[model samples]
Target: MKPELISFKLCPFVQRSVIVLEEKGIDYDITYINLKEPPQWFKTISPLGKVPLLKVGNAVLFESAVIMEYLDEVNPPSLHPTDPLRKAHNRAWVEFASTLFFCQFNMVMAKEQEACDSAEQELRDKLTQVEQQVEGPLFNGEVFSLVDAAYAPLFMRIAFLEKWHPMGLLDQTPKLQRWSEALLKRESVKNSVVEDLEQLYRDHISASNGFGASRFGNA
Candidate 1:
């Protein structure tokens, strides 16, 4: 039986899973969940109550990064590089993109503009380090690998954020800017991203007079 993916439309984390599924050419059932009313079963499987949960028979997976790795292991069109050093470099950037960059990006999403500004400065400093570590098209050199897979969604979200805020967040890191542009151009990335949902989100927030705790209801 094919796997089932439970995901939110606007979530970049969920988009990561979709990218892996497309890259692996896996046919699966996609169930869109209302972010305001996630199914009870989803919490049981994910434990963290997060979207982008994947279920295949008896196996269940959570966390977009872990889920993508699992899918890559079972499916074709490997997202990770075979070379040991390249693989390590990929993993490093993936980690930085998630833990470092996304954390800061989330602050902006959460409506902490001042905090976001500070976080963006800190993230820019970190991206300088990342820029020094990478030299070519993908973090692994010529091929798109797990790192690209992992970082793509974050970059997409950043691009969306840039559309509204234009904080010059990616300005200092030319490597990341190039990487993001290339990744966003991929069919897998393009198809996985829900641009409509992003626009809707922007509209919703605009209607609410900007995001606040009351707007999302204690999320």
Candidate 2:
């Protein structure tokens, strides 16, 4: 049976999962979710009420990182390194990207600019660490790996936010900046990025004049 992915068009988490599937050349069905009112059954399957859920036969997977790992296992793309230590390094970076880097950025996006500045600084520190740690094309060099897949969307968003906010996050992290620019040039990353929704959100927030404007206005 074919797999199905339930996701939100603009979600970075969902985008990561889709990039993995696309890179692996796996065929799957895509279901776009409404963040305002998701389906009742989706909650049961996802538990956390978040998107980027995958249904493969009787198994269901949530969390973009886990879902990507499963896809990697099933499809066996050359994305993961053959060396056990290198594979661990790849996984380590993915965890850092998802939990540390992405979480900090999300916090910044969810709050007012003043409240978000500190968090944005924290994000920059994390990105700086990433820059120091990773080297060569992709996180593990030349070949794109799970680390790149997990962090690419967040990296892309950092670039976008920098354009508008002028935060010095990317300025201090030259390696990460180079990696992001290179990764985004890939067809999978290009196709997976939800530019329309990203732009819509940006416009929505800008028109509101603040985070509350976007939230309350949407409400």
Candidate 3:
């Protein structure tokens, strides 16, 4: 049976797993569901009632990082290093990427400018740490590891946010800035979501009337 991925169109977590699947050249079916009103079947399969659920054979997987690791192990040409320590090191960076996403989420949900400012500065500080540790063109050099998959969405959202406001998160991190630009061009990153993702994101933030969206109004 072909693998199936349950996803929400705008979800970055879902996109992380999608990029892995695409990079592996795996033939899988994807089902996009409304997260707001998830169907009973989705609720039944997803332990956390979250997306990027992978149905492989009889097994179901939750959590994007877990799913990415599973896919890497099951498939050939592993995205992670072979050495145990190296793999663990990459995994640590993957966790860091998750933290960055959480910070980005907080920034997006911030209703007040002061809250958004705090979240944005926090995210910038975290990115600076990543910038200090960055290896190069990709997270782990030329090889695109799970770290890259995890971070692609963060940069994608930043790309959207940059259109509405000035985000100098990369001003001091030229290497990270280049990495973001490179990830944005990857086919998997570009194809992971519905077309017009920027528009959808803008709509979502505008609907919330968050600080990011409010900038456009004040401008």
Candidate 4:
């Protein structure tokens, strides 16, 4: 069955699944929806009323992590560490990526400079923690895995956020910055998002008119 991804165009979580699909050479259909004014059908079907939903046959899978794991398993040569303990560690970090996303959103939504600074510091601290775990080339050495897919969207968004705001989030950590660059250059990561994703992301922050908006407005 060809999987159909229900997504909000700007959702980083949804982009994670898209990266895995592209990396695995999985042929899938994608349908974009307006998150601000979700359709009635989406409202009725989505248990959490959120995107990154995978529609496979009649089974609807919610949550990006679940969807990515399912896709990896059904496809061959799972994108996870073969070592049991290492795989669990990777999964934990995959969950860690969620906190980073929340922090990124908080930074973007901060209405005051102090609030934005605090949010940025929180994000930076978490990133520093992530820096220590990274093995190099990819999340777990040279081989790419689902853990990499999970965090690519965060790096992608950070790149865009930094472009407009110059927060230098990754600057302090050489290893993390290298990992981010390597991931960004990967064809799968590069093709994971929409063509005008930067503009769309900028528009999102611009619409918010938060502390982030003031920084990105001129760019």
lDDT of each: 0.73, 0.75, 0.86, 0.91
Name the weakest run of 10 consecutive residues (lDDT summed) in model 2.
Answer: 210-219
| Tens-digit lDDT string for candidate 3 (29-122) | 9998999899999999899889889998989999999999998888988899788897898889888888888888778778788888888889
Report the poorest 10 consecutive residues by lDDT, candidate 1.
Answer: 210-219
Superior candidate under lDDT, 2 versus 4: 4
The residue-level lDDT of candidate 1 at 206 comes to 49
Model 1 ranges with Cα > 4 A deviation: 110-113, 204-219
Name the candidate, 1 or 3, with the larger TM-score value. Answer: 3
| Colliding residue pairs in candidate 3 | none
Q: Which candidate is the best by TM-score?
A: 4
RMSD of 4: 1.0
TM value for model 3 = 0.95
Question: Against the true structure, what is each candidate's TM-score?
Answer: 0.84, 0.87, 0.95, 0.97
> After TM-score superposition, what is the CA distance of residue 64 in candidate 2 from its true location, in Å?
1.3
Off by over 4 Å in 3: 216-219
**Stronger candidate by lDDT (1 vs 2):** 2
Task: Give the per-residue lDDT of model 1 (tens digit) for 1-219.
Answer: 699998888777788888888877789988888777877777667778888889889988888878888888887667787878877767666767666645654445446556545666677777678778766676767786777777788777677666766667678888878887888899999888665866765655444432422233223
> What digit string (tens of lDDT, one per residue) describes model 4 on residues 74-93?
99889998999999999999
Alpha carbon deviation, residue 89, candidate 3 (Å):
1.1
